[model samples]
Target: MDRSFYSRSSLIINTIESTISGDRVFTGNQPDDFALAGLLRNTKTACLLGVGYGGAVRAMLAGDPSIELTLVDNDAALIEFTGNLFARSFPGVAFTSETADAGSHLREHPGCYDVICVDLYSAVGYPRMVLDVGFWHDVREALTENGRVVVNAWGLPEQLSPLAPPSPQHAVAQAMLAVWQDLSHLPCRRNTTFVAPALTPADLRPPVDDASTRLSYEDHLTLGLIRLRGASAPVLLRGGIGDAGQPAPTSRRAIDAEMHARWPGLVEAVTGRAEASADFRAALSERKLTDAATERLLLEGSPAASFAPCIASAKAQLGELSMAWYGEWLCDEWFRLKALDPDWFRMSALWQAVCMARTPLGAVWPWEARLYDMLSAELLDAGFADAGV
Candidate 1:
């Protein structure tokens, strides 16, 4: 592993990358950092496990300077470096750095923290304790009555297509679910941040007067709330469709039928609207018409006449980019119709499009990400009939 540090604005970003793979093993100040900070808004004392460059520490302090944080890591040098850096950056915040294994620290200090963040990772992957049910029990025991535990687990399959082979994160998620009641996981790109016992929207709201942190807090809270929708239960439960304990969908028809049963007429209506818009655009291109001429032609005879209501309803409901992506998905689906698995087409296509449209800077537009979450929630629901632990 190789470590590097950089300064951005007022924050110092510490990153560790894999020497062999050259991929980031840990990086501070990501979206997940802000999300965790929002969760810790009202917390007084918190413990961070696997203090990789103190990203969470910086974020939590930024959100609530009064938070007393304890950083635990087995690496003495890393702990010392982080401790010294924070001592300079935040002159008077209450925090401590201890060089110790996270599990041992948790066992020694049961019921000691208001919030506990588990972010143990290495160049190889998540440590064995992360996937151990017994470790999770220790985590539960360490929390106060109303205390919350958030685990930063990576390599989770996307929520929309939950059929991938289970990763280490899946095992950790399973372990957490087994140990804690009301656990919920929020998927952000390839990482899924798991919190337990479940949090409500009100629990994640930003402080009224903290305008500087408001946008980041709200963005994360929006994702958190979207994950709370009832339809997200299955993906949350199994960590994807075919993990160890959950049964697969059986067949494409079964998956499609389930989707229709959950949200009747929604898929049909949206697809129809997209198809209508695509046809209208094709006609305009064929005629080589200006906007004025297109309006005159529409007055003569509407190209999307049959789907007028669907088009109008979709336009009213979806944002302009969302509608455009919806049409783009429809066009791609047409070519894939013969080879498409219904589940893949119905659930994953639009999601893949959203992922592809992410900005050059690697950030998804907030509204587009919200649209994906809303659409995904409507397309799938709980009750995977043979899919229980």
Candidate 2:
């Protein structure tokens, strides 16, 4: 697709200011989950497929004015609304809306972009159409030979469980991993990373574990900020929602009834337990061990692979990012949201600077607690996060 194909209409204006420091952001994670800010640091052409509020697009504008951007979303209002807002600031960039699914657009616009980001969210479980089948082929075709596709897979409802903090990134990474693995079937390529809370340094990096080969994952973990590992993973998730959604949370009774009917089976599938409930804090503690050990063991699957760094700058904040993960929602999401809703999305990401000092992924945020409640309250909302979960 040409510039005309990249520019469309209708958008929104709803900004969420940080509850703490008045910062704005997208949703959960920070600007760059793996410091992709650096990856996009010099990128000249960029596209956002599922532009929910379109914050990443704005980030690119601020980072490099020379960059060109295209944002595509199915929502006509959002498409039109954001188009106008950004049009004023980014005269040269493009914004468009389509009555089509992201995959269809990619198919039509072959080898056209430097970066293609899929920010799909819904209840059908990660827009299955985009994951396998023809979608990957179209996406590959739509991108420049050296282009990158960044997908933000929303985690599953059970994955959200107010019962505990969500494992959003794991699901995100896995979604891309499946695609990478499938594509690599051609035999000339290999998916670079499976960055996970499950993986340990030994699971990915060279085992020498000494100078010239000290594992960065461990350093980040010890410092508290885990860097992206493996090759630039195709996906990065925010949580793990199951194929099926959970019951509505309009009331504790409805939640309980639904839990009784479908939640237990789902929980059993993920945790392998029979109807036992989990706390978010407890889950985080246990998951850290389970995920790390799990990653270490996964190495056998790819003998030729070695661990890649999870963060572009693992030393940033001196490892505090890892520590504050559980306590504060990644402030980065705020900036992302800010890009869309400047009013509501305040820049409170720096709160991590302080919160990280108090807890290491142990404490939870009060507002996020309310957000989960709201997110769970709407049975209809699950559709918003279906893709990439």
Candidate 3:
């Protein structure tokens, strides 16, 4: 089968056609994947822990023709599917696929790959082993000097409503805390890709010089890019450990506070108004207002109108169904549904709602503190690392 044929999958091609018709588009997801491919510009060896849709594999080949790749996946069928696809797809590129656990493979071939792509996840969530600090330690041992480990953490708010309170039970939250905890000592930089609607396939055509990648892979790239729009950026948790691997703080409260400090104006606008803080404190102590009344006051009361724009942008970008369930679903139920829908704008709006719903009494509704982290990553990726607000 011609590799280009694979990009014709209905799952993504239809999205491209729809997006192109509307022309409502943004940067899409390739920049980050392209950046990842760029990491192997001169490298000869790379390893992928999960095959997913084989986007990273295509990326590595596109960047460097001679690079050798070892792809490990737990599922035998996926291994066969992608393995056969890559075999026929890029004959010139050295390739290997193993049917085994990623951790097991890393342990067997320690200090082997120049780039280790850790994207291991099942439909339910990230595997429990990915959360193990010891597994990360194994990852560290498996890297060559100057090598990089990129772990895929889905920070997108597809399944959880932003209206819900943050909890440790969420799988992504747990994985993030674990990643920082295990790799805190290592020098690292976080990179994020914001979820956006698909762009026209014409915008992402493969290089003309590489006839091998033409038609065949460009569609896949286009599809992969859009699919990733809803995913959290993978963090390059690289470099040497400091202070004997002093742990990074993973407390939800501490993280939220840090996020508030970084983008105070946005946080205030989304969560509460400048003057509303006084009213919130009063409402908590006076005990005169019911919780429902207080929530109404915070969300629709004085100065609440200021956040309407944020909510509007979120709704317009995220769609109605994505936002409607914000304050309605329970924690786990919301997580399950959000994963199926995965809308960034909707999540952003609901996050503001979550913030606005707050009282001095304490967090009552469900919300993801990681929302701040996700938004922060998006801002950073868009070159706002030094953004004043």
Candidate 4:
């Protein structure tokens, strides 16, 4: 897709036959070009459900011109527009265009595509069908043996509301998890491309022949892949859709109490190991005197004070470590501690912290402030933030 198709302006709206069709309102950066390029990599045949200006089709064709592409959209005007645009832009590539409902098309054609890209969205938001579990079941049944489904989903809510109905993005994610073997997310600032049967970062490369397409794919991977499973997956998926899990704490004291109860031995489990590590002790000893003094004030003699200094010193020595460092460290700790207390570690504050830390700097989408708030509550209750550590 060309740069013009990827609109930076979120306010731009396009209509087909007086029906609101395309806009960046709920789905920011709809038809994520780089994300589509990554998902369609190495695919022989692909079906694109929603054709908005043919950006996704252009991207898929650009990556691999020989792909047997199929375009399905409810709007005849869009299919015609895309056909005309492609005639001028990509005269050599051939693709079948069908005017039909996405769900009906998937039901009619089963196990035909190596890759199915679902970018279905109405003017209001994701249509009711996209949120239904039965719809995802149909999507799963339609996939080839090793087929992958890539969805352009709205960004997930930072913190799920227990009382509120799940957002379209969250509902879709949970539904996919229920039906698919695995689910992974390629998150951007606004829209997140969700992939079923989780793909790794290594799988996000473009065809070697297309240098520009390769560059675009590489740029999108900077944020990295978010595997949605274990604690990282939303709690609502515990017993499928209507189960909200536990109610979120409404007050500060209640939230702290919940955190303390959730991870009873978190501080001791993580920090004890850190304190015992000779490398951490050596690193702390080598810190500059001024820096050590500042960190000591930050530590303030908490239980984790000894090892927290090591983290501070490491940050100071390394200049500025990306949040990836913290994310990786958190994951390692979670795995190590989970064996001892599986229930305690599952869906605990640590995972929330990991999610927050791993998010690319400056790319955090709207409604994500709650992630930071949750992490803060954990740190405070665990005595890390209270001591300024």
Candidate 5:
């Protein structure tokens, strides 16, 4: 139950380990932020709904000073804390603190935002609004001329959307197909959609400046990487929306196995393994995580050799992961420290207050948020977000 115990630098290593060991890494499912960020021109303004701990808000503010930001979160305390923190980090950009639902806010300001994030972690996977058909409709109205929306999720690629593209995540893969067909029929000026993981070279057509305009080759590659993971949207557990179903640890093992099968070649390529571990720990050992030469191999073979440094960047994540892991452990150690020495415990918590790691593959706190933020933003920084996107 100690989150930190399991979240050490090793945890960060796990994300990159898959790729380092040469098994499957990136999942070809890019993180939300990286993918999302690329959608904006450098000077674009943006809004981050559900600011939670403000990771995405912080990253957005730091990465693009020109971007105007309005952060919304239901937690007043969290909103205030993150707002103030980011205010100091980004003094010039527009920063608004609104205590409201994501859907409701968008409804009030239609066609105004360049980016909208339907992130779940701030809600801890409970964005009830997404479950409603009417909600997505309002979201459609919320976009600016060339706007994009990213629904950050914790589900695996296959489970990202209910059945999968040409599908939805409501039920099984079949259910996804049904939903996609229905969604395709919905009123819109040619709304395009696809699951991130399953998008193939052929699936994404280049975006036409006008619907009839031919898409550039670069645009097609970008669009192709943003598909929802797997074949459909991730399946919601039996009860509420956003709650990942605990299908028993055994069930999860089975699911992870299925995930392994989807793209053996890519996973192996990233991890350099014949077969990835069901345990993942075995695959992500520091031996692999710290391989400085790892990126060299990837760089030697690809035209994207410019991305080689990312493997090196992934190494930076280890330190952040270590800090976050320490933070999590520190949180649980309050009582222990109290017994030994109150002063020591206070210092422990203070140390955790600062996590300074730029790379997602190494960051201690789950880089999932950054992954989504950068993915949503669409920056191909050679991290898992790059592969996943």
Candidate 6:
């Protein structure tokens, strides 16, 4: 087949010509990519996982100038390379890329995306973490209200082997099922390029498969749906919607108080400021963490070499532009500190600073609690603390 012929819409056949030359030689877009573009057509803010060759990026940009894209990949080199490429290619498009583990990224930056597209893959298949229920839980938390997570996977769901034997396909379906179950309370739909057990032929209509293309969209792709909820989950989500009893309070102070109550000793460990502490007493008349004294104290200490810029960016109060600059500083510091040694105490202080900078109101965010839980898990794993059973 010619190089153009190798550009199959379904990507079902991996031809030698296509394999050697790769998608770069393809003339037209794959139908799956087109469908992905369609899914993102109305999306103003989007998070894309596994930005392999910018196929989906191209499709996403084809829609509108209003699109704000955050492309993430675990590969740093790939992130830098594609980030620069897209910055140059789509000059007007608001785009950014980060080299991060998707699960870790979602956990740290919660409730940020309008649409999250998961297409992560490895040589063996999807990465082990991508199949994790925890990853989906994080994804669920990170999505905005009215947001939808469309996972791109191969094969039909029911046709895959069941959970008992744990085949690769089974694992993929299980992950999708977790997503489906998590959003079961909301509206959900699973779409496949080929006819799957989940969808009927009648549901397959119109532009999804034009007469010109006549391609089997069902066999090519499977999208798992998880509709975002407008209201936050219960004050405590044990692990993705389990035991969600009480309604979360609407007020900021109430939320902060609830967090403090749920995780005792957390504020002191995280912020280094306890209500009974001398520092807390001194700040009784102030805004506490956001006060000038706290900022001065943070800068007074010798921080990591990479953290100097973050310390430099700290101001008593900031204007809009300065606030944006401060945010950039915090993002940079978070990445740098995360890469550094596991000095839990030092890291906790730095992490708290980043969290405070990110949230101006001083109300603890979901990500903050998640971060503490992550640190606690690491500490427990390292034999530093009680298993707390």
Point to the candidate with the largest TM-score: 1
lDDT per residue, candidate 3, 230-255, as tens digits?
23332222221112123222244443
Per-residue lDDT tens digits for candidate 4, residues 1-389, read 23322333332233421111122101113343323433444677788888876656645554455678898999999899878755654455478999999999999989888788888764445566776779988887787877788887653321222113334455567667778756755433224567777665345443334333322322222112221121132232323445434433323344345434533343333334343443433433433321233234224422222233234322322334332233333343434444443322323324333333322222332323443343444434433332111
User: Which model is ahead, 2 or 4, in terms of TM-score?
Assistant: 4
Please report how far candidate 1 places residue 189 from its true position, in Å: 1.7
The lDDT of model 6 is 0.38
lDDT of 6 by residue, 1-389 (tens): 11221232332213211111122221121223323322332456778787765545644433233457788888887677666644544333357888888888888878887667676654344455755778877887887765667555432111111111223333444554555533211111111211111222222222222212221121111110000011111111123323223332223344334434533332233235323444432332333332333344344332222122223222211212222333333343443434443332232333333323332223323343344344444334433332111
Candidate 3 regions with alpha-carbon error over 4 angstroms? 1-37, 40-42, 87-94, 156-389
> Cα lDDT for residue 89, model 6?
44
User: What's the lDDT for all of these models?
Assistant: 0.47, 0.35, 0.39, 0.47, 0.36, 0.38
Tell me the deviation in Å of residue 176 in model 4: 1.1
Model 5: how large is the Cα RMSD against the reference? 17.4
Better candidate number, 4 or 5, judged by TM-score? 4
RMSD of each: 14.0, 16.3, 14.6, 14.3, 17.4, 21.6
Taking all chains together, each candidate's TM-score versus the true structure is 0.53, 0.42, 0.43, 0.49, 0.42, 0.38
TM-score-superior candidate, 5 or 6: 5
Alpha-carbon shift of residue 53 in model 4 (angstroms): 2.0
* Alpha-carbon shift of residue 223 in model 4 (angstroms): 12
Alpha carbon lDDT at 121, candidate 1: 69
Which residue pairs in model 6 clash with each other? Answer: 111-142, 192-218, 193-217, 193-218, 193-219, 194-217, 194-218, 194-219
TM-score result, candidate 6: 0.38
Residue 377 lDDT in model 3?
Answer: 49
Candidate 5 Cα misplacement greater than 4 A, ranges: 1-35, 61-64, 89-94, 122-124, 157-389
Candidates 3 and 6 compared by TM-score, better number: 3
Candidate 2 at 317: error in angstroms? 22
